[model samples]
Target: MSALLPLPRLPLTALAVAALLGAAAGVWPGAGIASAQGTAPTTQPSRLPTAPAQSRGTAEQASVDGVVEAVRQTVLAAQVPGAVVALQVKAGDRVKAGQLLLRLDARAAEQTAAAGAAQVRAARAAQDAATREFERQKQLFDKAYISQAALDRAEAQYKTAQAEAAAQLASAGAARTQSDFYLVRAPYDGVIAEVGVVLGDMAMPGKPLVTVYDPTALRVSAAVPQTLAAKLPADAKVQAELAGAAARITPVRTQLLPTVDPATHSQTLRLDLPPGTTAVPGQFARAWLPVAGSGDARVLVPAQAVVRRAELTAVYVAGADGKPLLRQVRLGRTEGAQVEVLSGLTAGEQVVLDPQAAARIR
Candidate 1:
């Protein structure tokens, strides 16, 4: 025989409420209806807004990054090998044309010059003696005291001596010119940007000793790609300014180099800055060059629409059915907040402005 177990009794109000909740769960198909009336349902986020792809103009302008440089920048090098004896100017010092900047040990040059001078003197003395002898020979020939052959020899000696004197004089001048190489002078009026050698430092021929730049004249040099360079007009109006500057600068002139760099596939463009610009060499700058035509269709998209994943770059484009799809695109130069799409995208397509927001759509 099994022992009889006693059942615990519940309160009437609690029993009635539990019965009602059970009935409601059974009546509803899933937890959705019950949660909608009692508890809150987890809400899904909405997709981000999409922007239409814009067609770039046939003639669009591209921005160029470059460096500011002086019109006349020279690195003076040693023409003769010698030890530096004097360095008159330091970095940032103002200089004038023909100003002495440095001096090298010229003892050997001086000695050589002195020897040449002495040879000139000796040659002159010999020439004078020869002249006197020739005159005496002439007088003797007139008196019939000297043979015709003796007079002829005396005349030949004088002529030979005169030639020797002239040769020596030229040699002396050449030696002096070599001696002048020991002295370094400023080739133009400018500021000394750098001093490469110090006093007592040995300088070899063709080694740089000093660098100078004319601060008044400034220019910006930039390398432009071959494709865009071809579209530039003959007298394209260009605007340039210092990087992160607050002022706009009107270029004095613009010049495109005739040669192209094959390795970079770019051509050099030089823009002359107007007078009184605070631009200096080695500073960063930018120039806006007008493009005449691309000769092909291109898409332009907002910069934020592009998504980057390591080496992969893509954008979320809206399909024909209005569904978001990922697209890989090749990018060209950037202008302001928009980027030129070279391929993998076409005009009239829509792209999600925020890629992260579009990820939740699926």
Candidate 2:
């Protein structure tokens, strides 16, 4: 019985394959462990301190955020369609009035003008010959050497030549005027804000090629709600706090736009920065407008409670479930540490007192 016993065996290739697979499995877990040790976990947002919102009736003054802008900003467009051949100026370059900013391909325009000039010269030559012929005919008729009919025919020919010469002269003028369109020029003294077209680019009529702005005359334009806009008198004196450390709170001339925006229900207020003020275009500005009436309840929160990201502004609102949720909000103006909340929150609701504490949520 002992001599008939036998052992089961696997093929040599199968055993080698199994050994390689087990080695690979072991290497994979070690690689995963190394990776897990090198990577760090994401940080969680910290819990922010909360406070109940309070209502503030109409105050003595209202402030609104505004952007400092150039009094005259223009996006220059091409008057003629052609391939751009040269660019004379770039972004942020200072330009003078009538200065050339760009040039387009002028071969076609030059050819047209040359042709017109040639026609004008030929027409003038024909007119001069006609005049000479008429004068000779008149002299012959005066001497009784030619008939009246011949002189009259010569006069008719002279008038026709004069008309033709006039037409050709007008054509030449028009062609020259059109040729001027191949050159783009600045309208006023300003700095080039942007260059939209490059050399060899096809520029079409009405296509924007560059933007220019007069940096000397800057203004701050803000959108004020219609409710507050109507209350402020037309002659109310406003003051703006220009941005930066060396900035001064100076009195600015305010012009209320007559129309109200239908969608936002706000009116645009243009505040002219006083002459000699050291402020640049596109800077942040805030204007303090005198408030008229009282008894209108509005919510005011600390400026630290609001979060700003580029064009988006938001705040942390505490829900009934004791969770703080970030919500988008529209902000009006700032009064020192306090800011006006235009929308997205109601009075008596709890909000995060410090937005920085929850910055990780963003």
Candidate 3:
């Protein structure tokens, strides 16, 4: 009651103005009133896109390629040098074994063979006369009409005549064989790949007259490095592709040439091809020789799952943490669509199909 004596009274408008100013100050920056009445901020979880389902299969280490080769090939040449009289077969002609391919001027050989035959006949006549004389002498000796020395001399003459006749017969047979050589015959059933002699061409010994090859017995030959030669097995399986046809072949033999080429450092490998296939010689081919003792249980995947980068090969493998990782892998042989994983992955592990996209993302 004592403090009320100094009090000053204010108008109603001034009191109302003071109240509005206080409210404005409360809504300005640094004031905590607006936050108390506002809603809380919210967050949403991120979602990654899912990959599509793809089909996959297991793979094994295998080698595959095609080779071109002739089944059998040989050069036909004249055994005796002479002028070519008749050419029966031409290039690209199919011929049977023992079919006449060419003929030489056989008049000379025929004359020689005829002379030898006449000599044999004359020798036989002389042998018959000597035998008759020996028989007559033997009868005389048995009756004591001729001396033992005389009978012995006749027997010696008869033996000499017989030996002469046998020699003549052998000479005649040789002459006949030489005459037959004038007619060149095919050594085997084959196609004439080349003709080196014309009708009037002079054929000489060791000179190629014709080249023949068998299409059915064709084989593929390849030069393998020395390092790889040791690993090749005698029974290893092989396949060849030629002229749009694929052939399955077996390793029948492996011939390591005694000499290795200084430049290539490789040896030749000859493979026996199956019958009824058409492979030609002088055609290039790619071959795979399986390394011996290199086969074992391995983790394999489809070949399509692997991608080649610069100087490296990579595969996409799904990790247990639900993320795919790009892995560099060493590869081995390829069997069909499957490939061997030499390193980087394990068995029963999941690998990404269409690894290109996965690799790109990584």
Candidate 4:
């Protein structure tokens, strides 16, 4: 049988084993395989990593939420009860001081005024005649052409007529003045924020006809908690954003209302706004009230360093062994990109920039 085998054939398994060994020893299997396996390793220089440190001397700023309000708001009411015959202004209309806003039915008043004027003219003529007659009677009595009794009668008549004329004149003047109340004019320069009267509508005395507001005098009114109320300064600076316009206003005054709201447990605070502002009433706003820093300094970290989980907020602080250690933090004010750390971390301690990575490591 050995003679019939002619030559000892090398097995297919032996060939494959030799090829694999050759490829492993840096020998080429083919052009593609050789390129993939025999190529020299790339030499990429390693970069020195830079660590993020806590920013220093960052001034902490406080923030509070509030609403925009107009400091000067007026409710225009009809002085006399009458039918609203005309309306010269509508809501959102700008008006000047003393500008006529509306008109009431003054036809009857005008007629009464005209009749009063005529009566006043007649009374004046009668009073002049009475004065002349009294003088003539006095002269005739001095010359003994008239009896004392007759002269006294004429003087009494003259005096009575004079008194009547004087009363009539005052009544006429009053009627004329009353006629002028038909026209309603604006008391000051402002914008009409509301209109409650229309043409032919009956307007009553003391009923609001329109609501006007001076946009230049705007403010933010907020109810601050009592615990934080003491920290608010009289001259505190404020910034308000309303209807896409932001304004910088100073606190002209701060008033704590006598009673606290039962539901909110907060006291009302009225903030005087700056002039030439255009914030509308009932618009929500945010405020910042500055509090003095404690004498002992504290460190600040980036905003991303803090993580909120469930009901707790925490940060990952690096230990001496370069491993992240989870620590709860008491956060304070946020100044731009940095946040004030009130507790949990020390001044020189390092906090991880990526909290998720630190959490996974922990």
lDDT of each: 0.88, 0.84, 0.74, 0.76
Between prediction 3 and prediction 4, which has the larger TM-score? 4
CA shift of 85, model 4, Å: 2.6
Off by over 4 Å in 1: 1-60, 292-362
CA displacement after TM-score superposition, residue 34 of candidate 4 (Å): 24
Worst 10 residues of 2 by lDDT: 245-254
**TM-scores of the candidates in the order shown:** 0.64, 0.65, 0.60, 0.65
- Please provide, for model 4 over 52-87, each residue's C-alpha lDDT reduced to its tens digit, 9 standing for 90 to 100: 445465434455678887777899887778899989
What are the per-residue Cα lDDT tens digits for candidate 3 across 1-362?
A: 56666667866686477567767776443345577558554432112233322223332223433356675689988899889989998888999999999999989889999999999999999999999999999999999999999999999999999999999999999999999989989999899999987889998889999999988877677777777666666665544435444554454544455678889887766666667655567766556555654454566787778879899897777766646677888987565877878777766666777665564453
Evaluated at residue 356, the lDDT of candidate 4 is 75
> Which numbered prediction scores highest in TM-score against the true structure?
4
Task: Report how far residue 235 has shifted in candidate 2, in Å.
Answer: 1.9
**Alpha-carbon RMSD to native, per candidate:** 7.4, 17.8, 12.8, 7.5
Ranked by TM-score from best down, the candidates are 4, 2, 1, 3
* lDDT by residue for model 1 (196-297), tens: 998889999999999999988999999998988888888888778697677757789999998999899999999999888887799998877877554566
